[model samples]
Target: MNHSSLDSTMMLTSFGSFRPLNYFFFSLTLLVYLLSIFSNVFLMLIIYFESSLHKPMYIFLFNLALNGLIGSSTVWPAIMENLLSDTQKMSFLACLVQIYWGYFYLSSAYTTLSVMAYDRYVSICKPLQYHSIMTPGKVKTLLTAANIVPLFSIAILVYLTSRLVLCKYTIQNLFCDLVTILNLSCVKSLLVNLCGACMLASLVVFPCTIVLLSYALILTVSLKASKGAQKKALSTCSPHLITFINFGVAILFFAVYNRYSSFLPAEVYILITIDVFMIPPLLNPIIYGIQTQEIRKCFVKTVRKNEIFFRICELTVFRKSTSEHNS
Candidate 1:
């Protein structure tokens, strides 16, 4: 398809093979989407209301959950719709919007993880200076940088992508990623594309490097400290480390699949592509919720509160019914 032909609509070939199981996929997608939203939202709400969780670490956790909600919201709803509807298509403008938000979310996630790693490092490696360094002002600044930098980077990418004349309309992946969109461009502006790729790489690499350094320093400090200190540091850093490793692996798989998509079968390609987006959002909340003691306590408390409320309501209804029957 030419630029004019793609001006209005672009087809998503990602879900084409799953047409026969559309309803099945629809139900599954909807369930996962709702679960992800609920988990992330629940975590954010806990952090928001719990005064004890107002520390720099939890503040970053809140932002991480918020990013998960935004990122998952960008694509899952569209996927759910496509599963229900016969057409797996979106408008060119809509596609661009999806691409922008999807990448924005990815960038935000990496930046947030980097910030969290730094927080852990300070807390574990420099316990005396932790509060002094991670003050409200500093935390606010970090949060601002984390959120704004991603938006700025993604906007440049969207601008570059929007200028490309389309050679095809069908995107092979489950969602509109920057790489897939570039592949569809008729005019392969190699220089511009190379520069764009470098910019994107910097976004990933800079933050990842910071995270690695922070963890390395933390590890070195832990080795010299007492056993209690080492255990404390491990407890605090384990969740962040798990999340980082999980996200890194997912992105690596996605990058490899995109580069070697021609070698993979349709089923394998689809699974790999979807894993990039699907796994992190769902897994992050679960990993954090279970692993972080404060979050786990808050979650249990909230659940208990709801259960008590329901029991009280049931008792009220039962008493009311008995009184009315006696009357």
Candidate 2:
């Protein structure tokens, strides 16, 4: 096999067997992609327009929605196009670009969730100092760090992986993931793997640990508070918790799929990969909008206002049509 040929193009084997149902899957994927976009955009709009929601929590929520949009946009469009095409091949550089953006998005998602957990913890356990501690400057700094750290980390990983000579070009996943790309390296990359593992652990495990500890503290404080206070805390924290758990499960499935790819069937592996990209973006806004009182109220108010506006437009059109017919 020519090494130059391997360097030129890589095949994504994940969709090789789905040719028969490509159109069906394409339609379904497009719908999911659109729903994810709409949900996140709606959440962001509500947060942006509602002055009442200008607090730190909603600010982080807005960033989370934005991250979801970025993450979905990074992969779904390519996946949809691949579903419609006969070839599942991508250039080597394109694969690297996908891997970088995909991992960067994942890192940012976890980091944002962890930050949101800390925000809730501070709000609940130290309400008096919430404004003082989570000031606009601080929130801005935290958001900057969340994004920068991930970008830097993934950049290093991609750089190291890119230096390797390739022995293979086929990736057995739905998308170009770092693990699959690393597996194609011709040379033994123990150091690369170890460095990648450390990066992954830092990006994922550290933030998750913070989230768990913060939630534990929040729960402890909630136990001592009154029923109403507890209910309020629960209402606020539940959405974050649900989103975190959903994201955590997806990450777990991803880890398992990577480590034990041989044991799992191709279909199962494809579904796991799809779930990682699909579920969080689709569910986060819905969970937050329904579970958070302020968001839900705003959503309801917005919907009702839109309904009234549409009704007035309909009446105007009806009268105009009737007048034109009479004339």
Candidate with best lDDT = 2
Number of colliding residue pairs in model 2: 0
Positional deviation of residue 112's Cα in model 2 after best superposition, in angstroms: 0.2
Count clashing residue pairs per candidate. 0, 0
lDDT of candidates 1 onward, in order: 0.84, 0.88
TM-score of each: 0.94, 0.94
Model 2 clash pairs? none
Per-residue lDDT tens digits for candidate 2, residues 87-148, read: 88898888889888889889999999999999999999999999899999999999898889
Tell me the lDDT of model 2 at 290: 82
Tens digit of lDDT per residue, candidate 1, span 272-303? 64566677888898998888888889888989
